[model samples]
Target: MTTSTTTPLQRWKTFFADRSSVVSGIITLVVVVLTLISYTGFLQAVERRSGVVFVDSIHRILGPIDVTWPTFVVLYASLILALGVLLTRPEHLFRTLRAYSILVGIRVICMALLPLDPPMTTIPLHDPFVALFTSSEHSTLTKDLFFSGHTATLALLALSMPTRSLRIVFILSTTALATFTVLQHVHYTVDVIVAPMAALLAFVLNRGFAAENQ
Candidate 1:
């Protein structure tokens, strides 16, 4: 009998080369892209969406900061950095993608199930992606407020990343985003609070499925 030990890179290459892994990656990408399109389409019609005006007391006390641009930059920058960390270890790629796909699916369902009017005092979140679909640069999306997608995404990154250090960074990043969203009156307090629980559930479920695949 002959036994061969595969290097980490070799293992990752083999996994990526596998039909199932490739399919998973492709599916994840498709889900992400489609989810974005669907979510944005929903947002574009927020003007007609049925939602009651919500008065967020948290935004009342904190008083929104005029840091929408800075917060947006930080959120996207942290996500990019987290991806860089994961890319350094190719072994983590597929599992992370699988978890992310589930996160997107959950978010889509949540958005459909819950309709929300943005807090009246919203600071006008300046997200470029959201801006692309809006007629005006400062158009505040008063709907699609079931949960905090930004917070959930960071929570997903924190849960899916392989290293403890990466996890901590992502967690702090998630916390920052949660705070920023509330301070900016971009999301209701409950939306930010409940996002991580949903992300964690998706992460756990995806982990079990990946283990079964192995």
Candidate 2:
């Protein structure tokens, strides 16, 4: 009998060939898509309501700047890089997706419980990609504050990386993204500060869930 060599392509094919793996991937993707769509609707509704604005000592010190381009640059580039790495490891990709979906659900709950208006010195963030899905009037959202979604997303990506080098790179990228969000005043200091903690909670929960299934 001749032995067969396992290549990267063969491994990927084998992964997809497993019915359980395929089902899990489909479920995760559906959950993520639904979570995102729900978040968009919630954001638009929250934008219509008014909330209290408070003073943040940190925001007072740094003030607001228009760092929109730089913010998206780091955010999207890091996401692309993380996806490139995670795709090679299909399991990691699924883990990241589940964690991210959990993160968004957490954010929605927190935002619902604590409605917040943007900072008094807020420089509105303009995301071109998000604009595509929203109406012109609802394009710039300011009330989805509690925790920073941008920061949490990058933090989740960092935690989900399968390698030390990738983790380090994502950690730095997350830090930069957090700084950019705060500098832009698109999020309050507390928002960015709590983001990593929220992300960690999601990551830990996802890991536990996966472990139980295993």
Candidate 3:
């Protein structure tokens, strides 16, 4: 049988035929928006009330370590690639996205309660990245210190993925990124640990929500 062309609205309705698909998509978007709000608020609060004295103190101890630009770039690239690949299947996409959302939300909650400063600002490191991390205008978003956001995001992406290979890649990429964060003095040992913990907590919440909905 020949098919007649459908209008854009009709096509949209057909595409979202499953109520679950549409509802999940909306819920996912809501979760994302909430996380963004929490993140932005946490950063602003920290910038207004805190200083870099603690980070400066830590820098005195870690200033001797040297990290190259190329290494940091490679680590960042690997992290993006791993997360990109895992976020692709439609079947698990919403669930995975929600998990990521929860992870960021958790981090924001932690940061709001316990704002930690990066070593660069507190230590007054001379590195370009350090300056960026420490500057009030530039560092506002990056200075929230409950955990490494990138590391936790990478970890959540990996943990929520179903495939073993993807999980392995996620673990490897997150580890590399976390290592870079610590070595670069962008985050502390506690932040690295919290990244995985945040992901784990998100995963648990995601699973519970999914089951309840089912």
Give me the runs in candidate 1 sitting further than 4 Å from their true place. Answer: 1-12, 132-140, 212-214
Residue-level lDDT of model 3, residues 1-214, one tens digit each, is: 1113544445445538878788878978787877766655556667677644254344456543445463456555755675565444444567777888878778767877776555653322233543343445645354667677778877887786667887887788788777666666667767788789888999999899888978
lDDT per residue for candidate 2 within 1-214, as digits (tens), equals: 1113554566578779999999999999999989888888888898998887988888888858888888888988998898788777777788899999999999999999998999989999988877775668989777889999889989999898877898999999999989988888998899999999999999999999999998
Residues 28-126 of candidate 1: C-alpha lDDT, one tens digit per residue? 678777766775666676657677676777777996776687677778888789777666555476667777778767876887777677887776675
lDDT of 3: 0.65
Runs in model 3 with CA error above 4 Å?
1-15, 51-87, 120-136, 139-142
Tell me, by lDDT, which candidate is best.
2
Off by over 4 Å in 2: 1-8
Position 61, candidate 2: lDDT: 86
- Score each candidate by Cα lDDT: 0.75, 0.87, 0.65
Arrange candidates, best lDDT first.
Answer: 2, 1, 3
* Cα TM-score of candidate 3: 0.73
- TM-score of every model? 0.83, 0.93, 0.73
